[model samples]
Target: MTVLDIDGIDTYYGNSHVLHDVSLTLAEGEVVALLGRNGAGKTTTMRSIMGVTPPRRGEITYRGEDIVGKAPNEINERGINLVPEDRRVFPTLTVHENIVLAHKLAADPRPVEEMYELFPVLDGLRRSNAQNLSGGEQQMLAVARALVQRPSLLLLDEPTEGLAPVIVDDLRTMLQDVVEQDVTVLLSEQNVTFAFDLATRGYVIDTGSIVFEGSIEEIREREDLLEQYLAVSPEEVA
Candidate 1:
C-alpha cells in the first residue's frame, strides 16, 4: 500500500524555485533512500513533505489523505515524524527529560523502558543534559524521541552525517530494527555507503531534480551513472 504519494510537487523558498515537478511514492513499511549531493534539494524535499515548506503545486497525500498545505504539527499528528539532520535535541534538557517531553505529546508513546532497550547507553545517561552527550548518543536520543510518536512514516534526513564509523553502524542496526517493525522510512542522505546499507531502493537527485531511481544493486552496478551525477565512485568507497 502507498503510505505517501507525492505528485508533481513544486517547492520554493522565498523567490527561489527548488523542486520542479518532483514526484515520488513510498509504500507502507518500505525503506527508501533519497540520495543527492548538497544543493540537490534533498532537504527541501523532506521539508516539503513534512509541510515545513508547503509545495506550491501538486498534491501530497499521506495515508490516503491530502496533506499538501497542512501545518507541520498537523501533519506530524497524522503519523509522520521527522528526525532532521544535526540531531536537534534540546541542549538544556536532560536526556530523560527530552524523551519524556516527546512522549508527553506523542500520539501513542512507547514506554521509556522500551526506549532504553533500543539504546541501552541512554539508560545510563538519562539524567545528563543533552549537550553533554556524545554525537552518537545524541543521534540515538533523536531517533528514540521520534519513535515515541509511534509514527507510521518516518522521515530521516542524513542521520549518519558526522558520526564515527562505529556509531554509524549502531544507528544502522537501530534503523534495521525499526524497519523490521514495519515502519516506513524516507531517508535523505549524501553518504552512499550508509544509504545503500540501510535502504533497498534509492532515488538519486541532482540540481533539484530526480535523475535516477532503482534498487541498490542496480545503482552499485552502474558506476558510470553514480560518478556522472554524484561525482563519486562507489567502488572507491566500497
Candidate 2:
C-alpha cells in the first residue's frame, strides 16, 4: 500500500523557488532515502510533507487523502512524524522528561518506558539533562521521542550526521528494530553508507529535483551516479 505520494511538488521559500516538480512515494513499511549533498533540498522536501513549508503546487497525499495545506500538528496527528537534523530535544529537560512531554502531545503514543527498550543506553541516562548527553545519545533521544508518538510514517533527516561510526552502527541496529515494527520511513541523509544500510530504495535529489530513483542494488552499482551526485567512491558508499 502507498503510505505517501508526492506528485510534482514545487516548494518555495519567500520568492526563492527551491523544489521544482519533485516527486516520490513511500510504500507501507518501506524505508526510502532522500539522498543529496548540502543545500540539495532534501530537508525542504521533508518540511513540505510535514507542513512546515507547504508546496506552492502539486499534490501531497497521505493514505490517499490530500494534505497539501494542513498544519504541522494536523499532519502529525494523522500519523506522520518528523525528526529534524538538529536532534531537537529540549536542552534543559531530562531524558525521561523529553519522552514524557512528547507522549503528552502524541495523538497515539507508545508507553514512555518502551523507549528504554528501544535504546537501552537511554535507560541509564533517564535522569540527565538532554544537553549533557553526547551527540549520538541525543540523536537516539530525538528518535526515541518521535517513535513514542507511534507514528505510521517517520520523516528522519540526517540522523547520522557528525556521529562516530560505532554510534552510527548502534543507531542502525536500533533502527533495524524500528523497521521491524512496520513503520514506514522517509530518510533524508547525506551519510550514504548509513542511508544505504537502512534504505531499501533511494531517490537522489540535486539542486531541488529528483534525478534518480531506484533500488539500493541499482544505486550501489552505478559508480558514476554516486560520484556525480553524492561525491563518494564505491568503497565509501558500500
Candidate 3:
C-alpha cells in the first residue's frame, strides 16, 4: 500500500521557487531515500510533505486523501511526522519531558517507557536538558520524539548529519531495528553510504528536480552516476 504520495509538487518560499514539479511516493513499510547535495531541495521536499511549506501546485495525498492545504498540526495528527534536518528539540526540556510532550500530541501514543527502551542512553540522562545532551543524543531524542507519537509515515531528513562515525553507526543500527518494526520512512540524506544501507530504493534530486531513482543495487554500482550528481566518487559507495 502507498502511504504517502506527492505528485508534481511545486513548493516555493516567498518569491523564490524551491521545489519544481517534484513527485515521489512512500510505500507502506518501505525506506525510500532522497539523495542530493546541500542545496538540492531535500529539506524542502520533507517540509512540503509535513505541510510546513505547502506546495503552490500539485497534490499531496496521505492514504488516498488530499492533504495539500492541511495545517502542519492537522497533517501531524493524521500520523505523518517529520524529523527535520535541524533535529529541533526543546532545548530546555529534559529527555523525559520531551518525550512526554510529543506523547500528548498523539491520540494513540506509545508509552514513555518505549522511548527509553528504544534509546537506553536516553534513560540514563532522562533528567538532562536537551541542550546538555550530545549531538548524537539530541538526534536520538528527536527521532524518539517523532516515534513516540506512533506515526504511520515518518519523514527523516538527514538523520546522519553532523555526527561522529561511531554515533552514525549507532543510529544506523537503531534504524535497522525500526525497519524491522516496519516503520515507513522517507529519508533525505547527503550521506550516500548510510542512506544506501537503510534504503532499498531511492530518488536522487538535483537542483529542485528528481534526476535519478531506482533500486539501491542499480544506483550503487554506478560510480559515474554518483560522481556526476553527488560528487561522491570514492569507494565509500561500496
Candidate 4:
C-alpha cells in the first residue's frame, strides 16, 4: 500500500524553481532513497513533503489524505517526521532536554530509557548540552528525537552528511532497526554506499528532476548514469 504519494510536485524558492514535476511513492514499511548532488533539490523535495516548503502545484497525499498546503506541524502531527540536513538540535539544551522537548510534540513518545537503548552514547551524556556533543552524537540525537515522535513515515535528509565512517555505519544499523519496526523511510542522501546499503530502491535526482528510479542492483549496473549525475564512482567508496 502507498503510505506517501508525491505526484507531479513543483516547488519554488522565491522565484527560483527548485523541484520540477518531481514524483515518488513510499509503500508501508518500505525504505526509499533519494540520491543526488548538492543543489539537486533533494532537500527541497523533503521539505515539500513536510510542508516546510509547500509545493506550488502538486498533490502530496499521506495515507489517502491530501496534505498539500498544510502547515508543517499539521503534517507532522499526521505521522510524518523529518530529521533535517544540518542536525538542528538546540545547542543550549541538554541532551536529555532535547529529547524531552521532542517528546512534547510527539505522539506516544518513546521513553528516554528506550532512546538510550537505541543510542547508548546518548545515555552516557544525557546531562551534557547538545552543542558540546560530537558530530556523531548530535546526529544520533537528531534521529532519536524524531523517533520519539513515533512517526509512521520518517523523512531523513542527509543523515550522515559529515560524520566519520564509523559513525555512518552505526547510523546505518540504527536505520535498519527503525525499518524493522515497520516505519516507512524516505531518506535523502549523497553517500551512495550508505544509500544503497540501507535502501532497496533509489530515485536519482539531477538539476530538479528524477532521472532514474530502480533497485540497487539496477543502479549498480548503470555506471554511466551514476557518473553523469553523481560525479563519483560508487566503486571507489566500496
Off by over 4 Å in 4: none
Give a tens-digit lDDT track for model 4, residues 102-180.
Answer: 9987767877678888888789898999999999899999989998888899999999999999999988887787777
Off by over 4 Å in 1: none
- TM-score against native, each model: 0.96, 0.98, 0.97, 0.96
- Better by TM-score, candidate 4 or 2: 2
| Rank ordering of all candidates by lDDT, starting from the highest | 2, 3, 4, 1
| TM-score result, candidate 3 | 0.97
lDDT of 3 at 100: 96
Candidate 4, 41: how far from true, in Å?
0.7
Compose the digit string of candidate 2's lDDT tens values, residues 100-181. Answer: 9999998778999989998999999999999999999999999999999999999999999899999999999999888788
Residue 7 in model 1: shift from native, Å? 0.6
Clashes of 1: 0
Error of 1 at 31 (Å): 0.1
| lDDT on C-alpha atoms for all candidate structures | 0.89, 0.94, 0.91, 0.89
Global CA lDDT of candidate 1, please? 0.89
